[model samples]
Target: MCIIFFHFNPNSASAYRLILAANRDEFYSRPSKPADFWANNGNILSGLDMEKGREGGTWLGISKKGKCAALTNYLQPVINMDALGRGYLVPNFLTQDMDGLTYLKKISLEGHLYNGFNLLTVDFSNTKGDMMCYYGNRSDQEPRVLDPGIYGLCNSLLDTPWKKLVNGKKLFTETIKKSCALSPENLTQELLNMLNNEEYQLPVTDIEEQGQDFIRPILEEFSALFIRTSFYGTRTNTVILVDAKGHVTFTERCLLKPDTNQWKVSSYQFELET
Candidate 1:
């Protein structure tokens, strides 16, 4: 999805080193396959993009190696829809064993191939000094290694001062502090509740944007922690928790449409490679 919130702690004493909650936002018309541990040799667990077929890739994915990646667009309006598939970035990262900084450095060399995008990659290859990085061509030319902390990403950039990002990160930090006992279900549910937050709305739309006039009228309506609009809104919410002992839990709550009363929730647990 377009928004992601993740906490990374490199401490070996902590039960969970990485906890992530995110939502995927897209137009209702775009058909996509739901998340699953895909059948094949790669064992890639992610939602398949039916539109792009095998090449479509995914918005987010985690491989068997404990490697994870997710991407968000930079909110830059580009008319050429066929420039390059930004969705491929995550799947590509998941299939490899490279460190976060190494992979990001290579991608930065080919940054011109795709439109503005912010990528988040986590490297659990090394049990000690685990690395998480934010690479965004629009936000900054240099790749930034994320320190152990809570961070939020939206359609803009890595840690941009968006209303939802700021609020979500704050609430997320508070939750982490209060739930120090490591109650997995409670903590993840708290994140899910935050994804349903509909508190803030933009008062006005920036007319400087090149060509998103269609959603301009309802821009304010879609400006909350969880977006709600008929044509475009949150389609899926995913939560992932990884403990220092190599245990991992991945969950996905899927919604077919914006106002559907039915939601399909699935959870999968696995172990990371040592």
Candidate 2:
């Protein structure tokens, strides 16, 4: 995940409404497919990175139990090729029977086994509600629960305000507040439109947090939300919405070519609780 902007709980009218629009920036030649792809081991749904050189894992995935997770690579000059594939973390969390806090605590120890990365997993196993927690190997802070609010994340820490993170957050928040009560279809459309935004032209930066250099140049394209470059650019855009009742709707749009508006879209819906 390169650019992810989300509204955790933008208003008081709702108990919980998580709306996330993300853009996956990568090399144009990278073989990937965006859809509700699932592995044979379980009914877990996510996109698939066909180039199996690494983990062949997914950047985001949702389990049959309504566990939702998304991961972003921590920008660094160094590469730990032997580290565990960060993409596998999402599916692993979904298949494993563990709460968000417990899983994050255990994974934090082996965080050094992989390169720096940020992982956010929302556990809805209780059937009562969902719990969201954010853990980053690069951040100095410990694995902490996030407050009820909108947040923007790119290559930097959670909300490091890298121009795009700051501006994109405002746009997403405003859209959430203005809607009366958005249906899943309506909400997904709104978020997809937001992801298609190519407005901001701010150059990417090398942000230093806690003495770590985080540099993501993909954010330097024509837009802060959707990025397009020559060799490497935004490969796919995904919109996911989960409401208070555990009803989940996921939609993804993938582009084969970087310069065309063509996209391959897929959607899935499932109830988390009876």
In order, what lDDT does every prediction score?
0.77, 0.74
Model 2, range 1-274, lDDT digits (tens) per residue?
Answer: 4778776752224544677888888878878767664647556788877776754578888876767788988777667778877888887888888887788889998888888789888866443455789999987788888887788887768997676677788778877776557767777788788777878645444443322432344334634577766777677888887766666778888896667757788888877642
The count of backbone overlaps in candidate 1 is 1
Model 1 lDDT at residue 141: 66
Residue-level lDDT tens digits of model 1 in 122-207: 87755456779889977546887888888898877777666667878887788777656757788778888878788764543431
Instruction: Name model 2 segments beyond 4 Å from true.
Output: 10-16, 37-42, 125-128, 203-219
Q: How accurate locally is residue 143 in candidate 1, as Cα lDDT from 0 to 100?
A: 84
**Residue 206 shift from truth in candidate 2, angstroms:** 4.6
lDDT of prediction 1 = 0.77
| Cα error of candidate 1 at position 142, Å | 1.4
* TM-scores for all predictions: 0.91, 0.88
